[model samples]
Target: MSQMQQITAQGRQIEQDSFAIIDHEIERDHGGHSFSPEQWAVVRRAIHTSGDFEFAKLFHFSDGAVERGIEAIRNGAKIISDVNMIVTGLAPRRMQPFGVEAHCLISDPEVIAEATEQGSTRAKVAMQYAARLGWLDGGIIAIGNAPTALYEAMSLCQQGKINPALIIGLPVGFVKADESKRDLMATQLPYIACDGRKGGSPLVVAALHALMVEAAK
Candidate 1:
């Protein structure tokens, strides 16, 4: 076979093997859980991405969150991320079928100026920017790198400024990361979050891909 075919084959094999390991370990270690098959798919992807079985315990999904996420993706809802990492991590091939696109305003000139002027983090300012642009409505807000962004997104949702279909609040940090996720859970909005600070862009990407896969099915 050609070199390109060899590489593709290797990649596919690696993913399959990794998932097999994840499934075996989860079944052995975590015998039972409240997550449904669809919810377990998202948690399993997160474990595959992080190599941490702890994700199965840490992850929390509001009622019907997985269903809401899949419905939104099927309807071509926009995905708004806190940082560029999530935008970069998301697979275009997976999203393209639904005409879905991921966006991040953290590096925008306007967000920079406003954040600097208001003495706020770029992540927080980016959420405000998204609310102003009306992109938060019927969209998925994926925050995985900055806790401040998660906090701001929660505030916007509570204040009736934005109505995102689902919020993936898994920002990783030493400051307010756990607190922010707890705050997200307190609200009535549909959300998927890691209960502590053990989250990152990879988890957000994995969660979105899980939803996309479900939507496709």
Candidate 2:
């Protein structure tokens, strides 16, 4: 059999082994946070996907996050991200069940022009333009690369320029990553974030994919 076939065939066994390790070896911290049943499913899946034990401790979900994300999926909310890598990682097979599409407009010429004219980064400019789109009124926004992108999304939401169903802000960097997440946490909006600079496109995609999996269920 082919290598791909072999891997596919062992999928169940792999999952079993992973779960065994998590259940038998890993332990939650003393007086640490815990998640709801649905939220726990996402966290478990993320740990399996990334092979990162820290995931369980890193993920922070605002109250009612799972329910809100599921409702948005059922309502056919679109997903937008700051970078193309995020859109690429979110496979169509997983997103099709919800009848939604993933979008990344960071490289659009208009966005570039707006950024140059406004003296802002393309990532921020993209968000500024996207905030005017009617579809994002209740869509999901994911930011995994640039901190400015996350800040723009939050600003748009706070100003009533756009209202997203949920925002997954986990951009990775030393500059403003931690501060952006802190700002997100301070907001009244529903959000899921990795609380420090230890985040990136892959982590953001994982969180989103986990939510989509739960929504499908």
Best by lDDT: 1
Clash count in backbone of candidate 2: 0
- lDDT tens readout by residue for model 2, 60-169: 88888778887888777988899999999987877888898888989999999889999999999888878766656888888988999999899888788998888888
- After the best TM-score superposition of candidate 1, give how far the Cα of residue 90 lies from its true spot, in angstroms: 0.8
Please give, for residues 171-206, the per-residue lDDT of candidate 1 as tens digits: 898898999899889889899998877899999999
Q: In model 2, what lDDT does residue 56 have?
A: 75
> Whole-model lDDT, candidate 2?
0.82
Cα lDDT for residue 189, model 2?
A: 87
- Model number with the top TM-score: 1
Candidate 1 wrong stretches, greater than 4 Å = 1-6
The TM-scores of all predictions, comma-separated, are 0.94, 0.89
